[model samples]
Structures are given as C-alpha cells and as structure tokens.
Target: MKDLSTFFVKDNLDEIVFSNRNKAYGAYALRNEYSSQLTKALFVGVAFFASVAVIPLIVSAFSSDVITDKGHDYGPYILDPVEEIPEIVKVTPASSVPVKVKTVESTIFTPVRDVKKNKPLPTEDDKKDAALSSETSAGEDTKLIVAPPAIKVGPPTVAPPYTPPAKVEDPNIVVDGTKVDVAADFKGGINAFREKVAQNFDTESVDKTGMVSGVITFVVEKDGSISNLKVTGSSSEFNSEAERTVKAIKTKWTPAQLKGKAVRSSFRMPISMKIE
Candidate 1:
C-alpha cells in the first residue's frame, strides 16, 4: 500500500507540471500575437502617412517639370530672344528728270466794221426836213425787211380717269359660272377663314380617323362673292371634313384689279384638318 501511494503521488506531480507549462506557452503565444498586431498596425499607419506625403511631392516634381517644359514651348521664355532681331535697311529711290511740254498757236478770223463820218448840223427848218426824210427812208427799209413764218404747237392729250367695275353678285352658294371678287368676296381674310374652320371643326372626327390637307381653288367676283369652289388636292382620310369645311367658309375677299379697274379674279386656298 505504501508503494502504490508513492507511484500515484509521482504521477500527480508530473500532471501539474505539464499543466503549468501549457499555461505558460499560451500566455507567450498571446503576448506574441498582440505584439505582431501592434507592429502591423504601426507599419500600416507609417505606409499610409508616407503615401499621403510622397504622392503630392511626386506630383509636384512632375508638375514642375511639366511647367518648365511648357514655358520652353508656349510661354514667354521662347519669345524673349525674338525681339532682338536687327531691322532691315531701306534704300531711297533716285529722283526722276522733268520733261517740257510744247505749246501750239492757231489763227482766228474776226470781221471789223469801219466807223462812218458824222453829218454836219443844219438849221431848224433843215433839221425838220431831214427828220421827215429819215422817217420816209425808215419806212421804206421796214418794207424791205422779210419776216419768218410762224410755227404752230398742238395741245397735249389727257388720259381718261379709271373707273372700277361693278361687283358681280353670286347667284348660287356653289358659285358656278359667275365671276367673283377675290379680295372683296372674302368677308374675313384668310386668317378669319382659318379661325372659323378651326373653331367649328370637329376634333373627334379627325382624331378618330386621321388628318387631311387640300388646296381649294375658287373665284371671287367683283361683288364679294365666292364661285368655282373646287379642291385641287386632298388626303383621303379627312377629305370629306376638308371639303365640308371649305364649302362652309363664306369668306369675302377684295376683288382683283385689272387695268386699274376692279375685276373678278381666281384665288387658291389651302384647307387642313389635324386630329389631336
């Protein structure tokens, strides 16, 4: 029994030593892990600071070189020496000799009249007799003088005043044969016709189907009336609507002028229908 107790006691001591060594190793491992983590954190912090500081310095160095090169190519550095070039010499031209021009002389003919000698003065009776004789001689000279024929001028002809033709009234709504006034027949202008058509037009009729555009030709008589209503062209979709609207339009337009007189003239109107 004593020997068995001794063996048990030895085994218990060995177990306690192994347990203590394991705990010491665990503590060392924990310390080494903490130290490693701290070292890594410090290294990371230093690298971050170095990158932030060095990147700007690197960019600054490259930027400085770029600025220097730019100055060499595009800045005032390349222009400073260009202002020192020597000016070119200009030579003066020699004076030209003057040339003399010659003058020519021409003869002109003029008639000269000789002066007659004055007659001696006579007595009063003699002077009266001379005056009567001179009067008879003047009358004889006047009879010898010949007169030129008279020229006749005719009076200028005047043009007749212009009178506007009477306005022709349209007998039928369709206005088939009667001549109509284009400007006077259309009561409202083109703008009025467009407004009326737009106001009365059925949007549903067009929108449900489509749109149609057509050119209508009609004559306006001297008497503010529309005639010869006909569609020149139209789209098939809204042709009926366009025709109806055009027929409904009772536009009174101004009659056309011919040779300064108001006359019936043809007018072309465009009708369009659009669906919203």
Candidate 2:
C-alpha cells in the first residue's frame, strides 16, 4: 500500500532474472551493457553512411570546372559583283581562199645508141666524082648509130682458156686393206676365193711354170666390183693368167668399211701353182 506506482523499479527481464544469481558471469555483464552498445553502434553506422554520401558533394563545390559555350563564330558574308561582257563581231570573205603556187621540174632528153652499122660501098661513078675521105658522114634518122670496127689483117690475139684447179683428193677416201676397220672380203671368204682362183687358173698358158707363186693386188670398189688389178711375178704370162683367173670370178665382194661407211680398199692375195 505505499504508492508502488510512484516507486517504479525499472529492471529489465535479463537483470531481473539474473538478480543475485552470478552477475559476475560474462553473459550477465553482456546482457546488462547491450542497450548502451546498441546505441553506440547505431550512431557510428549513421555517421559512416552520412560521410560516404556527403564527400562527393563537398569535393565538387571546391573544384573549378569551367564550362564555356562551344558555338562557332562566323563572319558576315560578302558577295562579289559580276561584270557583263560584250559580244565580238567577225567578218569573212565570200570567195574561196587562194593556195600557194608550186614550181614544176623539167627533164633533159637523151638519145639511145644503136648497134654498129656498115655503110654502103661507093659506086664507080660516085668514086669518080667525089674523092674518098675518112671524114664521118651524117647519121640516119634512126637512133644514134656507130660505125663498124675495122677488120684486122693477121690472126687476132685470143685470151687463154680458163684451166680449172686440180681436184683435191678426198680425205674420207679409200683405205688400204691393212688400214680399214673391216677388211674387204670375198663373198665366201679369202680361202674360198683362193680355191676358186686355183680352179679357174690356166696353168698350160704359163711359161716354165713350176709351183708358180705370185701376189695379186686389186681394189674392192664402193660398188663391190674389183678394180685396179695388178700382179707381180717372175713370168709375165703367169701374171697375165693369174689376173684373168681372178677376173673370171664374177662374185661381188663385201666392201671394206672405215667408220662404218663402205669404202674402196686395196686387197692382196698370193697365188701358187704347178704346171708339170
């Protein structure tokens, strides 16, 4: 009954619950200072937010950023005045214009000459009346004529006839049998050719022929015909008979070759016989 309302004991629930029950504990102390801590944190938060919002405004007010008008300045236009020109008058002649005169060249006339002509012989009557003279007579109306030349009495001198130079022997020429790449050979062979010669040779025609031995030489022509036939031996008749026997063999030969080309080549063969 003693004015309990007027004596209002303001004790929070945490304080009232912790009354005389270990107020020294950390939880109790934290509970008691919670209101003061909350008020201090609120004031600090408001100051931080206010400073953040006002810093840009404070810097802009002190900075000098001058803004000038960017419009271009142009001068007043001055137009140039145009002057009028008068038309020119021209005069032309009604007649055609004359051209310059040119000089003409003249050509000289020349007469052509004709072959020598013989004058007619004077008659006996004319010779009696007029004396013979060497003076030239008037020319005929034809082209300019010349007099005939006088004839010589003796044999006239003649230019010597041109003699042609001697022909040069061909360098790519016929070779001897020893010099040819491939020696000229008879159709069969040298032995076969010799056999034919011995068979055809006339031993009876030879003079004192006992084992007659001779060497016959001939050329194998490009056409494979025998040419330049010659024989050497003691008896002339034996030589002649040997040559005749070799000629009687009608078979052509294989021409000798030098550098793979057919060429004439000299061939030699020794012949022997007995006429007993």
Candidate 3:
C-alpha cells in the first residue's frame, strides 16, 4: 500500500520492489542487471555478423594480383615465308631398230624321161639337154597338184527293237498284309470268323477265373489256306484253347494280292473273355 496512485517512479522496479524484500535471492540480482546484459549481447552479435559478411570480400581484394600473376603470358609469334617446290620431270628412252633376215638360194634339177614310150617332139632346149644323156643325174620337173577327196562307203545303221521284261512269279514267298494291294478276308467277313471262334472255343479246358485274354496269329497262304497258327495269352490253357479254336475254322480265306497276284500274308486277332 505504498503510494500506488502515482504512475511514474524515479527508482527502478527491481530496486523498489526488492528493497524491503529479500534482495539476497539471486532473482533480485538477475533482474537488476538484465538491461546491461542484453545490451552487451546485442553488440557482440552485431560484430560477429559483420565479420562473416565482409572477411571474404577483403581476402579476394588482396589476392587478386597473385591470381593474375600465377599464369604465364604468350606473345605474338613471327612466321617465316614458305618457298614453293618445283615438280620433277620424267625421261623416256627410244625403241631399238629390228634386224633383217637373209634368204638361202636353191638349185633346180632336170627330170628323167622313159625312152620305151612314144616320144613327143622336144623343144630345142630339151633336145640340147637330152643329148647330154638320160643317164645324167636329174629328176622330172613336176608342178604342185592337189589330189581329189576320198569317198566313204559303209553299211546302213539298224537299231534293235525294244522288248518288255517278263513278270517273275514266286509263290513260295510270303509277304506281310500291309505290303499287299488287298488284305486277306474271311469267307463270311471278319465278324463271322470271330463268331465261329467263340462257338468253337472250349471254356471247360481253360480257367474261367477273373479275366483271360489272348492274341492269335496265322499266315493266310496264296491258296487261301491258314498256316503257322500261334497264340499268346496271360494263361497257357487259354492260349492253347484259342489256338485250337482258330484252327477249327476250316472256311477258306480270300487271299491277299500284290500286283493282281495272290500272296501269302500274316493275320492277327485278339480274343478276350471274362467270367466271375
């Protein structure tokens, strides 16, 4: 309750507020020195900022001459005038002259006459030489003559006529069904043969347990007779019965043909049966 009616005071707030209170506390001392401490901090901060901004510019100014002098300078050069070289000339040699060849001389001999034949009147030159004697070493003076062409005579040419080859037949050779032009067939078709096989098969001789299967193979001869009967099966008894069944069929087969001739061909059949 001191005179709070007044708005201004000559004493600072810290001096007055803490005068009667405990000034021994650190808060009172810190409050009293705040203005001076803040002023000192502001001046130190401004000096540090100014040095950061200006130090680089001052160093660059001082070192500019050293940077310029570090590099070497090249002066303008003087070039000598160039002389033009002359072209070289080539020389050619003259050709040599050709030598001439000489010809040899020949002597001609006189001809001899046959005195036994009728003699024609001789000229004065011949008569004078003739009196020299036919015994004189001489030959007949004949001019060069061309002989007539020879005629060639021969027998007329005759070509022999062509004969066709005969067809060879070998009935002993048996060919596969696939190689023949027409495959062999049963008298009443394949199904009829299968039915005949079923009727003729004797099941009593074979084990009827589970499933039994077999393949029967035979060769149908050129004369439509079945030979070389063979059977393959899971059971030996069934195989034997199947072979016997096929052989029982006596009906002749229309034999397979090759080039319109009957040929022996192999045939295969698969037979299977199941009994509980």
lDDT of each: 0.62, 0.82, 0.82
Q: Candidate 1, after superposition: displacement of residue 210 in Å?
A: 4.5
Q: Give all candidate RMSDs, comma-separated.
A: 21.6, 25.0, 17.3
User: Once model 1 is optimally superposed onto the true structure by TM-score, how far is the C-alpha of residue 205 displaced, in angstroms?
Assistant: 4.1
lDDT of 3 at 51: 99
Candidate 1 TM-score to native: 0.30
Q: Each candidate's TM vs. the true structure?
A: 0.30, 0.38, 0.41
Compose the digit string of candidate 2's lDDT tens values, residues 68-96: 89667787778898787878777776898
lDDT of 1 by residue, 1-276 (tens): 546775577546555656656645665555436757899999999999999999998898877543343334554444355566788889889888888899799889898899899776555744443434443232222223458898787988789999999987553333322343223434456677778877866656554545557777777777767667667544443555655766776655676654465766667767766565
Candidate 2 achieves a global lDDT of 0.82
Q: Alpha-carbon error at 13 in model 2, in Å? A: 99
